[model samples]
Target: MARIKDVAAQAGVSVATVSRVLNDNPSVTEETRNRVHDAMAALNYRPNAVARSLRTEATRTLGLIIGDILNPFFSELARAVEDEAREAGYTVIMGNADERPDQQDHYVRTLMEQRVDGLLICPTAEVTPLVEEVSLGERPLVFLDRTLSGVEVPSVRADGSTAIAELVAHLRGLGHRRIAFVSGPSTLSTGRERTEAFLRAAAEHGLEVPEEYVRVGDFRAGSGRRITAELLDLAEPPQAIFLGDNLMTLGALDEVRERGLDIPGDVALASFDDVPWFNHINPRITAISQPTAELGRRAVRLILDALHGRPTDSVVLPATLVVRESCGETGPGKEDGS
Candidate 1:
């Protein structure tokens, strides 16, 4: 499909010029407008949701940009947001950033051009300038799951420090001394925060977490598998390996299965995000459960409240540790998976 850039090229103008024309901006010369229209006709270009809400001063539509559609956590969060928006009689347009900062910026700009009543984003760590602009702009903007320090936007995020501490304590009690971690990329706030929380918890428990014990993954199954393999190859491998995200846990499990390693019996496993499937896995995986659906619901409420001239504040929800057999709790009559 042809994009805005193609229209700009055919019209011999910048993409911004095409956007202005589409929005019917009064600043554009009549000649330029004619050229843009001619280009559109020649190329059969179709404009996306553009400026329909300008006159009414409201689109009754909310834009939601997510980090990754493939992540089950984000998927559940999106569903909650959509449900809340639907109940409020507002439509939601979703954009998947796929964890790319540039892609995120693109969606933000496009949604603005579409004149969405508000925006909800699970921002990347890069902190694109456009996001800052939206926060400062007249429109209502809210950050979902992640927010930057200086952005000044209301956010709904989950705190997992307590859960991480509890998980560390559980592992220590299970007689697991050396525990390694597979973390997500540093380009996201969740990735950094979870790892920091784990480190703090490890230190509090008197367990040393060296640089080698921390491997960075891209929050994908492939990275989880590769990092787990690298960690397991160490001369003195860790007694347990904790995955920083749900998808990473899937990858780690694949590696363990291919190598014929038993859960908890070989190397104990844990995860940051708890999904439904985790419970079904043999020797159910121990995990930290985040308020994902609540985050989404709270984010929508914040945006709606702001748009309605009501007060709004950033919401921080808690995560809890869910212990299962994957980490192998030791007790009488237990199979000793730990």
Candidate 2:
């Protein structure tokens, strides 16, 4: 396919010149406009609808709906999507759901109003019906990270069960029998799957996980801190904790430090999702590192494939467990570190 750069090169003008001529902005010289038009004809450059939509309807743009743009994970994913979309000559419209169903629904409706060519969505926990409705719409849509039940759309996600099991096994190897599993709300598939995997992993190790030891909170630093404090005050505090998400991990770490308790020495910690700051912090946190970049790239590809009428299926990428100093008193063995 001939790109804008090709048209610009052929016209011996800058990309901006080509854009101006294509939009008929009345700001370009007649000679320059003719050169661009000749180049477009020679290269068979198809003007995007948005460039001509100043007086018409279609907007050659894509909408990206993320659960929480504040989180590094979602931000990175959004960045990747934006980069890919721009390279394909499409602009991206981003909307933050704040993990709220109503906000998500509003964003979807707003994006539709903007006449986006397609959508990439990370659905909120409570908006399954909304997701299904969008998927059934004329615009092509692809789900990212977590998927909605009964929604037959291409999706990209990490292997939550395997990642959780690996994290739990690593904790068990460090001699942590009584482990606390702190998680986000079980309403979402990611949270629910991770929590269930924690329980199943505990059973595999013949460890009894008491109900009090398992606490669910919002996927936030404050929730992590609050829940970690509650776990520590239990009659028999857990020797180790498997935290659900990155924000929750931050909260738990803050709580542990505030209490003057040493990491791995007093209460071991492990979490899902390895964010950028994980390594720089004191007593680096051990984490299950999902292929975030791969997930983002694959999600974009899936959407593009659907747009091109290329059939694709839901994809679950593998996760890597990065063993750091946060596991137990003895620390991770050489073979386990990644």
Candidate 3:
């Protein structure tokens, strides 16, 4: 098998210069880099990834732990993260927590055992003790989408307050008086922030959401369906329902369809996290459109910065309300300039 020595001899350069070219060190002149590449190709010299990692003490891999892979939003986020990681010359190993703390911790420990250079996580409901331990360790860590309080880890997320308010205003304008909410687990920062923002917005519009109208969900389709069914079965069912995320929105839509109810006529529907499928469905769903790709890219950047001993800061991108037929917003000027 061809080796680095063979490549160096063929290229008429020292092994160190070949190594620099292999490592993509910008210090190597373009001519030297081209010559080294030609030599490597001619000699069929393939660098051993394991040997390189052992020497550099870096695996060039990242661990991404998502809360739920079943959700389209999360799936899209994972794809974006992988794309960004790949662009930065890193590979990503992903773990799905399924919104469970134990599962999240298990993935964290397993990824650590695999010696991933850094970790990007969408935390589950409760802050696991394992997370704290990992944060204190030398390995770089960053939160994506969902964040833990007091963890001191940088994060990239969307600020949904304005979008929530816009949604509330849109619903109110559609003559919706009694509105219900299907909220995600309050233990997560995203769940808590979105839920609180909805309540605040509703209150500002002089609308009060009674206890019966507020249902807590697990950010899953089943919880959304169950909660939506409960809300619909109430003696005074709400005229509209706001879902916390896309998965629950699917659940709500399923339940609404099963009951032979027409959207925007029986119960108007809107949700956070706009997915591509939302547009293709009958009565296109209104949603809070987040910068999903940007969020993923920023999260990876933050982890890279941490790994390189550079300071990292949390990033909060803005979300905008996308008006559609589901929310009874067919009039002109209904959609935000998202």
TM-score of 3: 0.81
Model 2: colliding residue pairs:
none
For candidate 2, the per-residue lDDT at 40 reads 88
Per-prediction tally of clashes: 0, 0, 0
Per-residue error for 140 in candidate 1, Å, reads 0.9
Screening candidate 3 with a backbone cut-off below 3 angstroms (N, C-alpha, C), the clashing residue pairs are none
Clashing pairs in 1: none
Clashes of 1: 0
Candidate 2, residues 1-338: lDDT per residue as tens digits?
67677888999997767766766768899999999999989999886543233333547688899989888889888988888888788889999999998898787878776878788888888754445445644457888898777667778998878778877887888888899998878888888988888899889889899999999988889999999999999889999988889989989999999999988899998888899788887677888888887887788778777777888788899888788888854343522333
Cα lDDT over the full model 3: 0.86
TM-score head-to-head 1 vs 2, winner: 1
By lDDT rank, best first, the candidates go: 1, 3, 2
lDDT of 3 by residue, 1-338 (tens): 77666788999998668766766677999999999999989988776442233123579999999987888888889999999999999999999998888998888877877778998999876765567656655567899898888677788999999999988988998899999998888888888898899999999999989999988998888999999999999999999999999989999999999999999899999999998888888888998899998999999999999889998989999999899899785758774433
Alpha carbon lDDT of each predicted model: 0.86, 0.81, 0.86
* TM-score, every prediction: 0.82, 0.80, 0.81
